[model samples]
Target chain A: SQQGEEDPQALSIQEGENATMNCSYKTSINNLQWYRQNSGRGLVHLILIRSNEREKHSGRLRVTLDTSKKSSSLLITASRAADTASYFCATDARETSYDKVIFGPGTSLSVIP
Target chain B: DARVTQTPRHKVTEMGQEVTMRCQPILGHNTVFWYRQTMMQGLELLAYFRNRAPLDDSGMPKDRFSAEMPDATLATLKIQPSEPRDSAVYFCASGLVRTGRTEAFFGQGTRLTVV
Candidate 1:
C-alpha cells in the first residue's frame, strides 16, 4: 500500500482563485515534498517541508505539515493556467531507509484561464 | 543546471524480449531511485541505491527485473523476457541523504510498451 494519499483526486478552479490540495500519510516521516507533473513528462520538485517545520512558502506556493495528524497541504495562490498539472506528495518515512522516498497517487488540478 | 538524464525517452518491444533503461544522475548526488508509473499504480518505487550500494529492492520482481548502480553516475534497470503487463513509464530520481531534509530531482522518464 502507498504511504501517502492525496484528497480530492481532481480539482478545478479559476485562474485567479486559490487552490488547495491535501495529503495524508500513515507513518512518521522526516520530511514531505510536493511535486508537479505536466502531461507526458516527468515530475518537477516544488517544495519540501521538514517535520519540525509547520509551514513553508516559496513565491505563490505554500505548504503546511502537521506531524500529529500525519497530513500535509499545498496551497497555490492566485492560480494561473500554467499551474494546471498533476500534483503529488512524497514522503521520506522514518520507517524506510535514508534515501528512499515514497510517492502518493496525486491530485489532478485544472486551472481555467 | 544539474539534472537527471534518462535514455531512449520511448521504447516499444515484443513480449519475451529483453529491455534496458539507463539513467545518469546529477553529479555529487549519492542516492538514486527507480520508479514505475502506470494508469493504475501511480508512481511506484521499484528500487533504490545509496552510495553505489543496493539498499532496497523488495518492490521489484526478483525473477525478471534487476536494478544496478554500476558506477557513481549511472544506474540501470533491466527486464528480461518482458511481458505486456510490464509496459509503463520508468523514472529515475537522485537526491542527497541529508540530516533532516532531502529533495528528489526527477528525470524525464522512459516510456516502455511491450507488445
Candidate 2:
C-alpha cells in the first residue's frame, strides 16, 4: 500500500516557469524525501525534509512538509527543460524499522522550451 | 563518487524462466532497498535490509520471490519462475539512516521483459 499520494498526475510548463507538485500521505513519517526520474530508468534524490522541519531548499528545488495536514509540496524555481522528469514523494514510515520507504504515484512534468 | 550498482541492466526471458538480479550498495551504507516499477504500478518496495538483515519483505510474493543479502556489500533478488506480469524495472537503493539526514541513492534499474 502506498502512503504518499501526489496530486497533479501530469503537468506541462514552459521553460523558466515555476512548477509546484503536492503530496498527501497517511500516518506519521520520520522524513519526507523527493526524487526525480528520467526516462523511467533511475531515480535521483532531490531533497529531504524531516518531520520536525517545515521547509527545505536545494538549488532550484524547495520542499515543504506539513505533518499536521499529512501533506508536502515540492516547488521548482526557474524551471528549465532539463528539469522535466517524473517527481515522486517518498515517505520513511515512522512505525517501520530499517528504512521502510514508501513511494507514491509520481507526477510527470514536461517542460517546453 | 559512491553510488549503488545493479547488474544485468536488461533481461529478456520466456515465462516460467528463473531470473536473478544483483545489487551492490555503497560502501559503509548499512541499509538497502529493492523496488519494482511498472507502467501501471508506480513504485513498490519489494524488500529492505539493514546490516545484512532483512527487516521487511511484505510487499513481495513469498512463493516465488526471495531476497537476500549475502554480505554487507551484496544483495540479490531471485524469482523461481518469473511470469509475464513480473516484467518491470527493478531498482536498488542504499542509504545511511538517521532521521532526515539520510537519502537513498539508487542505481540504473534492471529492465526485465518476460515474453
Per-residue CA lDDT of model 1 for A1-113, tens digit only, reads 78899988999999999999999999899989999999999999999998899999999999999999999999999999999999999998787657468999999999999
Which window of 10 residues has the lowest lDDT sum in candidate 2 chain B? B95-104
Q: Per-prediction TM-score, please? A: 0.98, 0.97
lDDT (tens digit, per residue) of candidate 2 on A32-105: 99999998569999888889999998988889999999999999989999988999999977876545888999
Candidate 2 lDDT (Cα, 0 to 1):
0.92
- Whose TM-score is greatest here? 1
| Poorest stretch of ten by lDDT in candidate 2 chain A | A92-101
Which residue pairs collide, candidate 1? none
- Tens-digit lDDT string for candidate 1 (B1-115): 9999999899999999999999999999988999999989999999989898988888899999999998998999999989999999999999887787778899999999999
Name the lDDT of candidate 1. 0.94
lDDT for every model? 0.94, 0.92
Flag regions of model 2 displaced more than 4 Å: B99-101
**Candidate 2 true-interface contact recovery:** 0.84
lDDT of 1 at A12: 99
Docking class of 1: high
* DockQ result, candidate 1: 0.85
